[model samples]
Target: MRVLFASTRGSGHFHPLIPFIDACTARGDDVLVVAPPGLEASLAAREQPYRIGGEPPRDELTRVMKRVLELAPDEGVSLMTTEVFGRLGVAAMLPALEEVCRTWRPDLVLHEAYEFASVVAAERQGIAHARVAVSAARFSRSTDALLATVLEPYGPGITERLRTSPYLTRLPASLDPSPYAVTHRYHEPSRPGALPDRWGGSAEPLVYITLGTEAGAMPTATALYRAVLEAVSGLPVRILLTAGRGTDLRGLGPLPPHAHVEAWVPQADVLGSASLVVCHGGSGTVFGALAAGVPLVCVPLFADQPANARLVAGAGAGLAVTPTGGPADDSAVLGPDDVSRIRSAAELLLKDPSYRARAGRLADEMRATTPCRELIGTLDPHS
Candidate 1:
């Protein structure tokens, strides 16, 4: 069988599709990727053939994204879903992506939840397709209406195809149960790798901090970074902060000797040793922390991070402290009070054992999920 995997430019949307793609390739199936040029470096490393799916012009994208950040998180998600993915993305990439579907004629098309072009193109071409979720939130409430409008060009009942299609996800169902049924639960992709060189197997509690891949580029990130550093200041725990790829450490100014700063670190390597994780509540970090049985202190910025944070907090696995008011107001500045709250939350989690116990239980539940590789056979359109 031949499989065509598709995603937009963002890392959050792209990572969830990897395990399934790798599963298809490992079985000797022909595979190709459909993505934009910004992701070439990431795709090149996969060593598979890919056609560049052109994206919206940069000026238009920048104009819209600027407005998105200025709005509250919910509003940001709404506009982003309708304009960015629903209209701009489809208008920009559909022609090229649909052409690929018509030409490549792969056995199946798989796409992340937000990559609207692929599913629409697959629908237009009558190809088999599936939806791979990036987060446990499932995006049902958020995307249903937008998809209904965006999917109309292909034909009637396009939304039904998405509904009945094979759905794969890494949803830790017990922690954040979906309102709808989860067709299949898949484990997060992981590989053993060396920890950051600055880390020295410290016996003291290790607090891992990461803002995910794209958060640093947000206008609000600088203040959040400063606040996170300040929140952990004077704490007894040793800090290991991954600043995301291409981040310049010098921009962060001086750091404490006890805090280890690196542009990148093997998350799997550090999660096992971390006593607690502080993050932007991106699904990757939230899910990774839970799977490793490490509690999280989530400072959600936008998108689904606030919900992810709340679920982690509600489950007693960790705390959620949004310096920017999270979904309420994205443009709000991080104040000292917010920083203190983060500090207090971090301290409480470290001082208490209940959080870790709950996190460990969630980890056990996630580990019991079927691996993505095991689900490849289930994608066959013909029963």
Candidate 2:
């Protein structure tokens, strides 16, 4: 069997596809990938390449994203879904992607959510394709809407086909259960690295802070970071904050004595010993924290982040600070009270054992998920 994998660029989006790709290669299937020049280089795939580079022009994407960022977090998802990922993405990726499908003629095209070109190309070429979920379950409606709107010109039932296709996800059923009938829930196959105990058996808890790579580029995230640092100040626990590469460290000013900032961390390693996590509620971070059984203080920046935050809070695994136009109380919109809430929430999570207990339960669910390697037979044509 031959499989082609497609996804948006970035670690968060790209990492979820690893399980499927690794499964295909482990079974001796030939594979090709369409993605940014990052870890995909390490993926085992066929040598011949497709130069699939038609991302929206930088200026236009920037102009559109400017408007997207300006809108209240709730108002932007539609525009982001319709334009950025839908219209622009289709125009940019479809031609070259379709050519790849026609040329390579793989038996299957597996894609991560938020990437539609591969699905369309597979439909056009009459090849089988499946989608892997990269976030919480609430996305299918908006995602289905986006595909329906973009796929009209190509053919009928393309959207419906995707809506009912085999779905794969790493999200535990407790987080956001899949609505799909043919869903396969599983954990990624890679083993987590060991975390070296810096304290050498000292009893102090470790708090992990990561706002995700995209956060570094956003000014809103800068303010959120400062607020989180200030909020956690004077706490007995030690803090390790991973400031993504794009963040303006100078803009963050001085850090509290208990907190140490870095460009990145071995996330799985850090989470191994972390007692609590403060993050932007990205799927990867939220998922990682849950898998590690670490509680969270989620301050959503945009997109599905707020949903992930609410999920964590609702599940009793963490607290969420979301946006509102109110004069006081709310994050990203109103200011100081948000920090107070974060502090209060963090304190509550640290002191009470319930939150950690709930998180541990979720972690058990995560580990119990069927291994991705076992599901490959379902997609493998030779089987």
Candidate 3:
């Protein structure tokens, strides 16, 4: 089979598909990756054949994203579907991606769950396709609204592609919001370098803190980072704080004596030894921490984050501390209560045994899931 995979520019979106791409190649099937121009080199480094699926012009994308971010939860999701995926996504990439499909004539098209463009193109060419989920079903609820907007061009089959397509998810059944998604065991992608020795295998409790790349870029997230720094200022634990590629460590306030700050670290490597994880509730970090049997202290910023935080709290595996105001508000400035909540959650996760036990259980569940490689057989056109 000739397989084509498409994803948005984010690493979070692209990483989930790597296992499948590798699986196809190892089986001697031809494979190619479709992504924006900036991701071309990264795909090349992974030794995957690639094609450029041109994205919306930067200025237009920025404007559309700004508008999408300002909306309330349901409204935000609807706007994201219509604006980002509809306008900036499919509308922008369709011509180029379609050209690739027409010329390459792939047997299967696999795309990031929210990147409906590839699915639409596959439908146009009558090719088999599936959605690969990088996170829980954060946007599934709004998909019907998205389908409504594109009903004329793509019709109701697009709705099936969005809502009920055969798909792969890293989240265990417990964390996955959609029952239709198949739980593919999580596999950390191979990184280029060795793990940093910042934690030092300390017997003291170890906490790993990161906001992921996108969350770290937010001004509001810096405030949360500072609060976390202050909360753990004099704690007995050894801390590994990653400021992310987009974050400047100097702007994150003074580092505590017990903390080590770095621009990046292999999260999977750090999580293996962490006693607790503090993060911005990115699905990657949430699942990473859980898979490592480390409890979490989630300070969600926006999008699916707040819900992810709540899910953690409800599952008894972690804690979620969120700003009282809406997503659009400047949540960077934390009041005393907010700081206390965050601090207390960290302290509790460090001290409590139940959180750790639940996390370990989730880890076992994740491990029990079918591996992505084994599941790739389902994508065969003959099957």
**lDDT by residue for model 1 (242-299), tens:** 8876566677788887898877776789997889999989998888888888999998
Clashes of each: 0, 0, 0
Top-scoring candidate (lDDT): 1
Question: Scored by Cα lDDT, where does model 3 land?
Answer: 0.76
| Candidate 2 lDDT for residue 105 | 88
Q: List, residue by residue over 1-383, the lDDT tens digit for candidate 3.
A: 89999988777778777778888888888898888876786787888778787878889888877887777665766776677766677777787778878889899998887777787778788888888875566545545456656634765557656566676777777765565654344443333344556555666788888888777777666676787777766678998888877776778766766788888877777887788988888878887788777899898766677778887898999999885542445544556567777788898888889999999998888878776666777678877
Ranking by lDDT: 1, 2, 3
Top candidate on TM-score is 1
Model 3 regions lying over 4 Å from their true place: 142-144, 181-195, 199-201, 325-333
Which ranking of candidates, highest TM-score first?
1, 2, 3
Q: Which scores better on lDDT, 2 or 3?
A: 2
Question: In model 1, where is the ten-residue run with the lowest total lDDT?
Answer: 324-333
